[model samples]
Target: MGREELVRRVSEFAKESEETILNQVRKMGSSLDWSRYAYTLDEKRASAVSHAFVNMYEAGLIYRGHRIVNWDPKGQTTISDDEVVYEEENGKFYYFQYGPFVIGTARPETKFGDKYVVINPNDTRYKEYEHGQQIELEWINGPITATVIMDEASDPEIGSGVMTITPWHSVVDFELAEKHDLDKEQIIDKYGKLLPIAQEFEGMKITEAREKIVEKLNKKGLLVKVDEKYTHNVSKSERTGATVEPQIMEQWFVAVDKPFKIPHSEIKGVKSGDEVTLKQLMRTAVESRDIEMSQNGFRKTYFHWIDNLHDWCISRQIWFGHRIPVWYKGEDIYCGNDAPDGEGWEQDPDVLDTWFSSALWTFSTLGWPEKTKDMETFHPNAFMSPAYEILPLWVSRMILMSSFHLGQVPFKKVLIHGLVRDKSGRKFSKSLGNGIDPLDLVSEYGADAVRMGLLVGTAIGNDINFDESKVKGYKHFANKLWNITRFILENHHEGVPKTLPDKAIGYLDELKHIVAEITTEMEKYHLYLASEKLYHYIWHRVADQILEETKEVFASDEEDAKIAMSHTLNIILTTSLKLLHPFMPFVTETIWQELPQKDEDMLMIAKWPHTKD
Candidate 1:
């Protein structure tokens, strides 16, 4: 279908999801201005990203070169260092022969039709074979012979005393090819098409090739013996579970080591010495650290990732995303510091990783290249709220990239919340079918109710268990607030009292104190504390005490009662909306607009309540 049709379908889908969608929209009201919203696919967002890239390129950070990369054939994309997932599996080591030498492979099937096997020369059994001559390739039963390349990953006692080499399917081969300057014979194109050299196996599916080649080798009497059921680690494509082909190909790369400082160690000392800006850099580094470093040493678990970080690969072979701006002119290529001017070069078809664009989200969302008003005030906003799952993926990268380009952390504070788990503490996943539909929850419980429910028991960096009972409880609290507001409106519709009574003096000061604390906590990225404080203030102080105590006064004396009632109503309504703004932005916005107020006012840009001088 066409692009317009797709957009329409998605819009309609969202529209059909009424109660939940409206609630979420209301929850997100203050933190996000819907009028200025930009999705990744929006052209305005693309234009902003285009500008950010040019600025970074001109600053001499973006460059290109050939490097080893993770390729996902299903998505036709290349992911960065952070995207790869490694898992261990079971396989067998094959003990076989080539004319007169022994070979071993975790993938016994891969040894089929092999012309070479690499044996470490130090292994006494093959020391005499030196340069591809005959050696008795006898196992307990038979013989094999193939060329050997020396490597230590092989065990002399395992199978054939030699590790097999398949440049077409392994990372070990890629490294060895570079060391020997060997011409790589990996003949599969990115599209899984066979190159001319793979003639016999050309046009065969990789799976088909595996089966046919193994059968041919068995028929030719090349098979010596097989060891069944070996457990080992195998590299699978991150996007697709298909076995990865590590064929050599020219691919783009960025040297991430330039921006990262590897910790000092005995074998490798990476400190920059006098040139390093450790003091200022340390401040930014500490900011990225847990605000209050976990007492249980959780940061230690996070160390392995930061300690041995690799230079990232940002280019991807995809039609979507921001395409790398570099262009090629024959053997030499040109990197564009600006949008390519009319020239003879063909732009690189590859797009950058999706994270690359999102790395600029904090600033690009605020007009990065040119200094706009929003850039000046909120470009470096007070804080950032991110789900804890992305701490390693998006948070760390954003900090590094923002520090590199803007000389500041993207946000002063990082507020992280854990995933919403089931009551049994198991993480919700699609495959397990334990996942709760957020829209369904929002429909049943209003947006504000659902948000409050999520944060009720969740501390910073803590997981929340989903319980519909808790959601209904919060919905009941929301109903209390609505009914209480209705009662206040019936008693008093005028503005807050100009003068305070001796009895109300203490309560007014308490109200002011709560507002100040909520404002401080919200600015510091402590939304949970802020929400709870507002809930406490409304339910206890206003609903129970103020309404009950002031009822008799309103019945007997109208003016004085109106003053006290209006004062309490205004405070509760404004504070509730402000506290609820980030989590349930849309509903808060709707409630804000419906409040007794002036025309032409937008709830989102309203000044966050601050402490009095």
Candidate 2:
């Protein structure tokens, strides 16, 4: 399909999917402000993206550079390193005779681009070869000259203790080339076909070329030996499932290690005049306790990622995103929010990476780039709850962008939740046909039941093995709660007394302790513990014990005892509903509206119950 038509169709599909998601959220009774809803592709967000690009470019943090990237050949786009999925696969390791050294490589197809033979400097086997010594190597295409270089990155324990450097096809090779200023040759095209440099193997697929080249190398007496049981991790594109090709491409990148002056002094010890790199800013945000994670292990993960950070590739070869705000007219190239003030200036065809816009979500959604009330109030969001899979992709980029622009972390605390898998502990996928439709679950049991079932036994940062039996059980709990509310309303007297009766004082005190414990768990971001506590307290303690005991008081003739019993029931029901509201909002709110003594019009906005000292 044509690019424009494809973008149009994809956009329509995206809008429909977005509306379906919003409807499901509303059905689940989420208390989000619909009026302030913003889309990444909306005009305001587009403006924010463009503004950010221009600002970063002006600050020299964003630049066009030739660097190695994970290129998705099927998608015809450059994806970030985090988007690459590595899977262990069995392959052959071929050892080839190169002049005096025998080098090992798994990809003989990429050998056509070999620019250097790398060896460990400490390896005595290669001591005769001095650094920068030119050597003639036998090749399928004929004689090729390669320089010998010694570096510790080459493992002396590996096969042959030496390797050929294919700079255009490998990250380590590219880094070595950059360090030594060596030449790079591109042997693979964007279409994954061998380039003309491969001679007779030109235009052949990489797999086809590998077989053909290996056969020709064996005939030329250059192939040493092949280990058929070589197993290694191969990088593949998460979206297209194609093996990712490491290619050097000219793309826009955010220089994460480039130092820049802090624009704001809101972050502690990071004054406005202080200079820091994006990596430093992100590390400081967590190390200084400015941003706390729900799990301590996630903090370590965040720091490890930051310490090994690379310049971010921010451009994509896609049509349905914010087009890069760069224009070029002949020799004049401009990076700005708008096109150059002249004719014949064509804007860059590539769009910014999807995550580039998503990274600006916190501030851009609040009308950033222009001082606004929402930005001032919500720039440093108090809490962020996102799936753990995005800790490096979406979460880290958000931190990097926010620290650079706002000079503060995006959120004070991040609760990293895990994915919900099938009951068998396998990830739900289309191939497995194990994906559960949450809306169907909501229709079958109810939103509240499904919500509570999801939270009941799930721990922080742990994957949930969803079981429909749990939802069915929670559905029964909802019905029980409804029955308890009905019994309380039917048996209670006219007024809710200020104090608990002496007989029910013990229940009141127990409820107070449970409330305090639940509050503490919620404060620590332990939603699972909070949900379990609420379930047990409402079902066993209140329904089985207190409600059954109060029946005796209702049957008595003393009006004051019945009144005190009713007051105590009222406090228990209202407090329990408030505690459960976050997990089971719909049912709790519905039951709250039926109660005669509620302080707020909406149960969602009611004051959280607290324990008195």
Per residue, candidate 1 scores C-alpha lDDT tens digits across 188-217 of: 666665555555666766655654555565
TM-score of 2: 0.97
lDDT of each: 0.61, 0.89
Candidate 2 per-residue C-alpha lDDT over 1-613 given as tens digits, one digit per residue, 9 for 90 to 100: 8978989999999999999989888887788888999999999999999999999999999999899998999999999988999999999999889877788888999988786888889999878888988987677678888888889989989877888888998998899999999889899999999999988888999988787899999999999999999999999999899999999999999999998888786775577989898898888887887888748888888888888888999999988899999998888889988777979999899999899999999999988999999888887999998998899999999998898888878999898999999999999999899988789999999999999989988988899999999999999999999999999999879865667667688878988999999999998888999999999989998899888888888999988888888888888999999999999998999998898888898998888999982
Which portions of model 2 miss their true places by more than 4 Å? Answer: 495-501
TM-score of each: 0.68, 0.97
Global CA lDDT computed for model 1: 0.61
Best by TM-score: 2
Name the lDDT value of residue 88 in candidate 2. 98
Backbone clashes in each candidate structure, one number apiece? Answer: 23, 0
- Name the best candidate (by lDDT): 2
